[model samples]
Target: MSKRAVILAAGVGQRLQLAADAPAPKCLLRFDGRTLLERHLRLLRAVGVEDVVIVVGYEHQQIADELDRLDWTPRPTLILNPQYRQGSVVSVAAAESALCAGGDVLLMDADVLYDVRMLAALVADDSADRLLLDAGFEAGDEPVKLCLRDGRPVELRKKVADGLRYDHVGESVGFFRFTQASATRLAQIVRQYAQTQRGGEPHEEAVRDLLLESPERFACADVTGLPWLEIDFPVDVIRAREVVLPQLHPLL
Candidate 1:
């Protein structure tokens, strides 16, 4: 009955132009002197998640070398996704296959920056399938449109209708807490999409599709006040440095 975490870090980070010339992938981008993955590992370990797995692609060797240098006595396992260029879903599927067949797994996006407290709350909460909903400050195509019914997420589409305005915090904070059953279900969906050559779609695309095709499979977890940021493009790098650096430096 151990808790685990799987970080999907294989994407090429096409928007992060610096990644092309940098020494490591975007996840390896240094913020306040520590790599993003190192901070995430510390946060996960603090919350009793001793077993960790990271799916690496796009400069995956650099990621592997970084991990090898760590003196983390009992290091987490690393899964290399050969088809990482395919999409996030493929990276997730790779991690899922590496996980213990029947244990709970926490899934997170490698590029997201957030408060450790959010993760602590997620670890403590009990949810069959939890999706963190951010009450964003802006309304743009960057964040998923969270459609709620009775205080729960009923539908999450890419864009809402024109002139329809709701506070959209942004895209997923890249973190999820799940039971083995939920992990298995999600993995099944990802696998189905990957095999059928539809894996190029967004990770949430598959999740949303599953919900539409079968409503009983997912649940929403409230994280309205949590401070989080998703670092995808160049501008987000500054934002990530601003928010994640201050909080993580002292710990690192």
Candidate 2:
């Protein structure tokens, strides 16, 4: 079976822009000497992911130009999500064709910086559907939260109040691994969701809905110690550089 990955990088990252005079797309932002997108691609490649499909919309041409300059093997296939401003789920929906291409599909946000071990752990797990969970997570209203029951996710939501009630909750790391069957089903679910709700539904909510509808389909892997940072704000970038990067060691 082939292994494929999808990177959702179409957002404008309005929050990060507050810190920079002329900000690029979040994926294109530099950390240390390499761009976040570069690190993600290299890490994916290192973990034996054969093909990559990147969804681009906000500043699509800039991302394209960067890809054009790279000489990396197994070149990424770019899919355009014209409705990027609507919701992140649109980008995942845009890559449905690629996701259904008969393989384990790895889906991740582009704004995160993570050690390769996180990917390795996800890939190593044989679950049909799995999500990376950070047990040592800091609570915030915006971060997606997961409630786990016996190592499997029972609930996932973004509201802080909803998650605060659970004792066994973990924060979602915006990384997922789906078997081909689950990927196909997810594509169908997103399509149906798009038809009913115009836009603005987060992709994580769709996944949460899927898990709730079929609790037997998903599991969670605790990746608490693995260094990773989701770069949403300027402070997150500093944390990624000062805290997460140093721990990553030889991976960077």
Candidate 3:
């Protein structure tokens, strides 16, 4: 059972330029009143993942203040990613202690607007290394895909190479479950990147490295038809509020 989670919320969000009503850190973006951060904490808490570690940078204090405002039970730990501007992987690697010490950890992206069922599916799965997938995402080079052959994740990338054959492919929910051993290994992989020129690469690189190295270590559950969207570009923010939010089960 994964009892803890590491949320990467450190990026500058340069692409998601909003008007005057902009959310400085992006995690504070609200849907119908509750922020994405609030929603993430609430849903994770509801699913029994009480111990959370959030990596903060780029308006980190605002996030800290938001945490104080929420005062969520079993307080979440906040880690500062000094090089948040460099790459997403640094944010993940910044929480190395949380990822490596825990028995199993759920790794997540904080900018996502999703239904509670999305969290529910991952918590219920006992797989050592698990990925949440959605077959309904719009096709493009944007979404990180989980390519499966015979139901096992063989590749995790934005674009699959020329001759790869996969029976199933879906957009990664950017939420994952990693067992203790795998989590420790993943931490090692990214920590090295955090110290090198490769630190600029997205966090997905480390995840894919592990996935391709040990394809048998990963399994995925499809959450297609579930309303969810990663709040990246301004257009996505509109989609989240108009499309994804209305479909979510109301906050309890």
Candidate 4:
């Protein structure tokens, strides 16, 4: 049983702009002599995911050129989201369109790094709509907060919750394994928000809305104590180098 995966990599990392010399997108940034995108692709390949789609924007041509330069074998399809400047939801939409055929879609962010076991765990779960959770954090720390009830997310991105156990992590390091209903709903959510024309709002807002609207369909694949990091600012680069790179060396 094979699965399809899509990486939403089209966002412009405004934080990296603080540094003038580093012209590469965060995905193109290298750690231990391998680019972040390369690392992600390698991990996916190792785990038996061959049908990958990368949504490219914010110097998309640079990403394409880099891919050409490296000539990564068994290359996955690349789709350009013209509305990438609009928001990540648009990128998600683009990836959704590039599916070519229908199957479960594993949605992920390109800026996040996670352990192979965590990826395996999420992929292994036979749930309809699953989320990889990092239920270990103080309030207001995790950049993307998930509010859950009965071991599944009930609300998303809400800062304060009385009955919810929220441990804020830098990013959502888990994969969204979609069923047919989930895939349709996820695509519809993207289309809805994309039409609203709210530029630069976080994609997680739309995702939270989706989860809240239909909480019963979502399941929690709690991935605590896994090595994960979100690459946003220069500090994240340091953290990725210190933490993710070391753990990933054997795989690379």
Best by lDDT: 3
lDDT of 1 by residue, 1-252 (tens): 567888888888878777344646778877777778887888887777878888887788888888887766468788988998787888877766754367777888888777777787677655455667666546776777666554445566667656643443334456776777767777888888889878787777766765555455445556666666778888888877776456542462
| Local distance difference test, each candidate | 0.71, 0.83, 0.88, 0.71
By how many angstroms RMSD does model 4 differ from the true structure?
A: 2.8
Q: Candidate 3 regions off by >4 Å? A: 19-23
lDDT of 4 by residue, 1-252 (tens): 457888888877897664566455668887778777877888888778878888887778778887787687778688888777676777776665644357667888888766777777767755567777776644565456666555666656636456656433323453577765677777777777777775356667767777878888777776777778777787888888886667753664
lDDT of 2 by residue, 160-249 (tens): 443343557888889989888888888988887777774588898778777877777777778888899889888898889889888884
TM-scores for all predictions: 0.87, 0.93, 0.96, 0.87
Return the TM-score for candidate 2, rounded to 2 decimals.
0.93
Query: Which runs of model 4 end up more than 4 angstroms from their true locations?
Result: 161-171
For model 3 the TM-score comes to: 0.96
RMSD of each: 2.9, 2.0, 1.3, 2.8
Lowest-scoring 10 consecutive residues by lDDT in candidate 4? Answer: 166-175
Q: How many pairs collide in each candidate, listed in order? A: 1, 0, 0, 2
Candidate 2 vs candidate 3, lDDT winner? 3
lDDT of 3 at 247: 94
Q: What would the per-residue lDDT of candidate 3 be over residues 128-234, giving only the tens digit for each residue?
A: 68889999878899999888999888788999887999999989999988888889999999999988888999999999998888888787878999988898898
Q: Whose TM-score is greatest here? A: 3
